[model samples]
Target: MRTIPLITVSLLALAVLAAAGCNRQPTPTTGGEAKAPPAAATEAPRLDEHSYAEPDKVKTKDIALELNVDFDKKELSGSATYTLDWLDPKWGKLVLDTRDISIDKVVGERADGNWRDLTYVLAPTPDKILGTKLTIAAPERNKRIRITYHTSPNASGLQWLTPEMTEGKKTPFMFSQSQQIHARSWVPLQDTTMVRFTYTAHVTSPKDVMVLMSADNDPKAVRDGDYSFTMPQAIPSYLLAIAAGDLVFKPTGPRSGVWAEPAMAPKAANEFSDTEKMMETAEKLYGPYRWGRYDILVLPPSFPYGGMENPRLTFATPTAITGDKSLVSLIAHELSHSWSGNLVTFARARDAWLNEGFTTYVEMRIVEDLYGKERADMEKIVARNELKKEFTDANRDLQPLAVKEGVLKDPDDNLTGTVYTKGAWFAEFLENRFGREAFDAFLRGYFDHFAFQSITTEQFADYAKANLLDKYPGKVTQAEFDAWLHEPGIPATAPQVTSARFDAVDAVRKAYLDAGTLPTAATTSKWTTYEYVHFIEGLPEVMKPEQLAQIDGVFHFTGTPNGEIAQRWYPLAVRSGYTQANPAIAEFLTRIGRRKLIMPTYSALVKTPQGLQMAEQVFAKAKPGYHPITSGSVAQVIADAKSGKTQ
Candidate 1:
């Protein structure tokens, strides 16, 4: 996730020094180094990361209280007050994790208290004394303690995050990514799993603009004009979110809606129509509609992850719009979080796959319901292919979902295909094994039992082992989970091919035969002597004659293309090869070229680099009302390459 370029992962060896110890306590830093950047000033406000856990909650059943965020055109108005439960009888120096954040007002129960600010590259060290530690003879279990302060916004090492643009200006999207404990970057609180607190956030923006947060609005979930909203949800500081933008809401899916502004709303809503069905399906499968109504708001181009599942409202990247919403599975991915993540949460980042992958596996239900199984498979395979491109044998720096919290070197990149794609694969594998009915029953049982609670990979594995072992006894074992999770590799189990209908070689060869003859599944399903003849005839002129000989009988090409293959192959014949290398390779190299004819191949070429590149080149040149046909992979490739590595 760091921009610093290195030839190989060798640089990661040095990276260990930056994050050596996860439990190192916070120590105050000299305030003179640099001032904390303001929170996303104009965009939605975010939740403080370290504020979620309540060490006192272990003994005192008091829930943590409201976070006050004011983004008025004044100073960065950031303040938090921890109102403890009145029942628990205990008191200690109040713990809050403040990163680049600064304190402006700290008013303990009686303004008689001491607080410390801590600083370390990896952890915050408490040092700044807040007033003096004077125990206000208030209830140790239930009492109000406010820590108010103003701080600027920061990239926080997550790059290109921004709110949707208004006119010529772009607002800053306010949200937090607490994956590896970056929550301390904003607020001060014990950033640990040992604490669980109820959160209510007050986000103030403009009088006309709407404010959305992690939870559906409490009784306070309602809006008071355009500028303010009170969201009541039992959110860990990490899941806290606020996105403020000029969003145009499209009310299509019965309480379920998709948001967009002038330029994006109409299309976004139209594209996200399936969201309604997904919302409905999720409710039926996952127990109740917890996030209230579902709303997906598209952020500006720079929005960090594909989607941020901030409880009720999801923050998604506009870059995925694809004009037609052709790639909106991200919408479903986020929605499933309502159950997998927002409900059955993860205790730490190490087992994050539970949150992300669970959402992915269930996401198929959402997509398949609306988009049909075939299209879902088509899109998923395309995504998987993109994931494959990022790995170089998939073993370097690999860690399981059991990884410690806030410790992964590159947190942003950690949500790789490994978790997203492979995790989805694991889910799919389970579904295929158990059959949809049993899988759904198991998932529902899991969510209903664990809803509103945190779950670990180990816990889930235990659950799976107990339940799945009856039929799949010993198959879904700790060993199976360790191999799939704790260890670095893809799950070795393969899905049973019911019919054994498809052949990769046959598919590739028939594609060649059907080059001029538009291929049908039947023609491309068999690899025989005749198919070889079709391939030779369809082979590109640039292909070397010898290369043709190497794969002469193989019928399919590998990454290691022989000189003969490369030379004789025309870029068009195989460049955007996914479905058209005669038997294409999912590629995005060439979006539709300057010539619109290439546009016809847009859908077919979507999963390849060449197709995406071509689309980008073509889009760079606008011929009026013409939307660029670039694929998601091209955009990502450009980002990864610019960031200095392929993955």
Candidate 2:
């Protein structure tokens, strides 16, 4: 995480993402014959479409860049030029998206290296880069291409690096996150998730600067005593990163190292001791850690997200050191990504569950092995409740996990417990059905097969179907994956307790309640969940609502009421006896918020103006010891409601 001071990206950022045109390059083939595609067919092509086709391997892509970074000011100033091969051969327009930026320079040319005759320069505006009627002509499918450009740091994540693990004068510290800021403003590429690439980023920083790409660092060379490093892997354009800062290194665990600010390297080594364990567990489970050395450098606050898994060197949030290794699961999660998310890129952002879920899945298993199952389970319960609350409160219904890659409205939406928890459950389901032997085998196999490759949700599903269900007896089906991945709903389940010998499920419920473990009350089968609010709201709708209420009430008859169940059952206890379930509701209301009636999903709960006002007042007035999620959700509700309010 290179700490970049937010300043102006002085000129040179002339990437007109708003508009771009396709220019083609001809390449020699097996027959040694070479030709360029027709100009009409290779006209302006969509950035994403140019990369994705019905195939497994990617062809070589040539991109040239020119950036001018101010050594004294820590500012990046430059513009970019590009030439792309057209697969579709559609003479449309070239467009790029930039945020909080302006195009300061322009240069476009076709493969022939001529300015106006071969290619055309487009318009770079506040929104897009458009050229009047520029058309690209090329062959139908495969063709060699070249794009050249010049730009400077005008965005959030652009960074300059040195070898000393520290910030400095020439390359103070810089890294770019194009998600919130614009990546295209600094470098030139096919800036969409739709197009995954194996790129060779020939970054020309200061002669004394050391640049780190999101691939394995091959070796460092000095041109006229200036530092340069070549990256050794193919990664997505989004995953493409550059860390230019004063860096210091601590080596460990066979090629694993930590690159930190020169001032922070020693402290980072002492603090990141857990990384050794994280790596061992991660390596044991996933395939061999690919990135030659794993290094983490701290970055500024605006460099959002827990960490950016840039191959071996991960960019981390400085806040990760809560002074405890307890939170280091983030380390494991990111490291685990060496295989799951990084190696096999997600088809789209909506299928983000694949990234997060696989990370979380490996994280739990790693933590359980490193720490214990009890701690893992405790974390699971906490995550479950948090996720449950978010899904319940938010207006946006859950989208299928296998969604096309893109951002959800609230970036937070993707990390919802629905994705993490249920997504973990999806992994757990695989492990339970296939056994760890087969499960790990499949994970390793999948990664090995698709390393540095792109895949679709269907392709991953196809892999699962071919490897698991097709081989196992009564294994999980594509239908199950479809239902969970495509459809959004709380997993429909409840405390199922039905058997040939049992007369009533109440006895089983009692047994389950008495014992902390789920009762083996029924024959082995699937499970369902009980959303307490809906059941309480439509009391008469259940198979036996009153009995269900009474049965729930018994759990709250007497207890400390501090645990998750007591917090809920106490309210049901109050409701059961008086109406259907009396004691539980009363206790919760009286002890929690007597005036605040339980509402449908806490999200909708505070939508009313009055509700939000009351909530804000209560939140501010409430004791500080209360749960953070409870307080945060209430605050979010109040804020959304007030912002949505006319006044």
Candidate 3:
């Protein structure tokens, strides 16, 4: 998963960009941006802090599963059969991580081709967040064990949707979000990124629904109730995904397609038409597309996250289908994951930058190749601003590119701007320091060297010392590399990314702020979402109702069809007490569940007394439809407001 940080501003407090120089004519700078003194650096956590399964003792090598999807009960009753590789010859038990799952029985495959019952224990959960430990007595000679179980109605990983929650409101839908250790809620496994396994699944759903997985898929396949899929390459447990719905498919290219509800299939196919070109560009930059076929499943509005790169099939939010191709960069981001995240994996959650940062860097390269350098620079500028805010406002301990041991209580904590934006900034720093050609060559070699493997930050550092830093003489020192990895806040020596188009946008914003001049369509008509976000971010924190009304009159932001622009503009409306955007905000909250877009708006709303009341009113109706991942976050925002814990 890739994280896009939320930029929430306070109505009563001054905005950072505006307070810096609202009236000063803005100019793009071309050097490293300075920041506050950095906190002491810490070593990367050696252990996967979020998992209880010790893969070093006995690891899961392969899995075969048979599951039955029960929409009425909102549960999945299945049997997971695992083929294990006992690294410890004397190991007596196979312990797996599970959450809210009722175990029916455990059976072991005997050497005589017969199955015998095995005694098992569901140990008391050490941490409620980590769930229970399923320990089974496995004979040293036996290599296979099967557990028949059913998921809880409140399983954190699975979301069962009623027909009404979908675009084509005729059939029920179901999907899984397993990232950050939630996979245990549905399937018992060694739920750690350090463990990789090949899997084959036989899943049965309602006759009217279609099923797809993170495996080779046929867009033209018939919608039968039973579906069997196989993923030949070994992958971490989080990449395990399944979606069943009333969906239709449309081919975007010879090897790429789109899966969406009938009403959305065409729009999604059109929006992501450039996906094949992006894949080709990435292949040229790195290596071949190892996933065989690249397809996108444009999930319903309730799908949480911007996109989940689930191997061959990427689960994406419908928000990306913005009619225009402006949002295709998200497609590029997910496609790049085939090389960075899926092919070469991160061993632990703290080393998530290995997955997300590399993917983000590759995503930018693809965008620059497919689109233009200016567009890529605009994105880099957006990320740079987000990272700058993280330095000033985020927790110091969580500000490092590599999080320390035991600092993370939940795996989701790894999805911070420090891991995504700051990590990408470091990559940008390297490319700038050692010429782009050298850095590109290094990346290509790095991926090829570690293909189909999971590695830690320490391993990456050792590899980089040998291959990149050693190869490029005096470009960067070990101290600088370590500081970039472990230190809090970006180093003052980091490269600064500037965008010329954004400088022009800032000049327009300064003119509006200084002379009360209204922006004309002639100067703003061709602006993309990046310009809109920058202009909105530079606006005065507090504005008169008429001032906001005048801007809304020109931009019609409240009713804009673009979700990215709506996310940036809604908070401004809330802070300025512009009641006209209230209906649209409520509609957006109810219609979409992407946390990156909604969290900031909700945070902004809770700061004001009136906005808090409205937020509560809208959330009361919208909360039930949201995925567990998203609802948990928004619920915390609302709870913080009620407890006067707004930060």
Best candidate according to TM-score: 3
For model 1, residues 378-476, the per-residue Cα lDDT tens digits are 555544654554555553454444554445544334646667777777777777767778888888889988877776777898787777756565445
Give the candidate order by descending lDDT.
3, 1, 2
lDDT for 411 in candidate 1 is 38
lDDT of 1 at 304: 34
Query: What C-alpha lDDT does candidate 1 achieve relative to the native structure?
Result: 0.50
Listing every candidate in turn, what is its Cα RMSD in Å to the true structure after a full C-alpha superposition? 12.4, 13.2, 14.1
| Candidate 3 root-mean-square deviation in Å | 14.1
Q: What does candidate 2's lDDT look like per residue over 468-561, in tens digits? A: 8787757676676567676664444211112222222334444544553333424312221122222232222223345554444442323333
Task: Tell me model 3's lDDT, rounded to 2 decimals.
Answer: 0.82
Q: Mark the regions of model 3 whose C-alpha exceeds 4 Å error after superposition.
A: 1-46
Shift of residue 533 alpha carbon in model 3, Å: 1.0
lDDT of 3 by residue, 22-133 (tens): 1111211112121221233222332466776767768898999899999999999989999989888866667678888888877888888898766555543335788876
TM-score of every prediction relative to native: 0.63, 0.61, 0.91
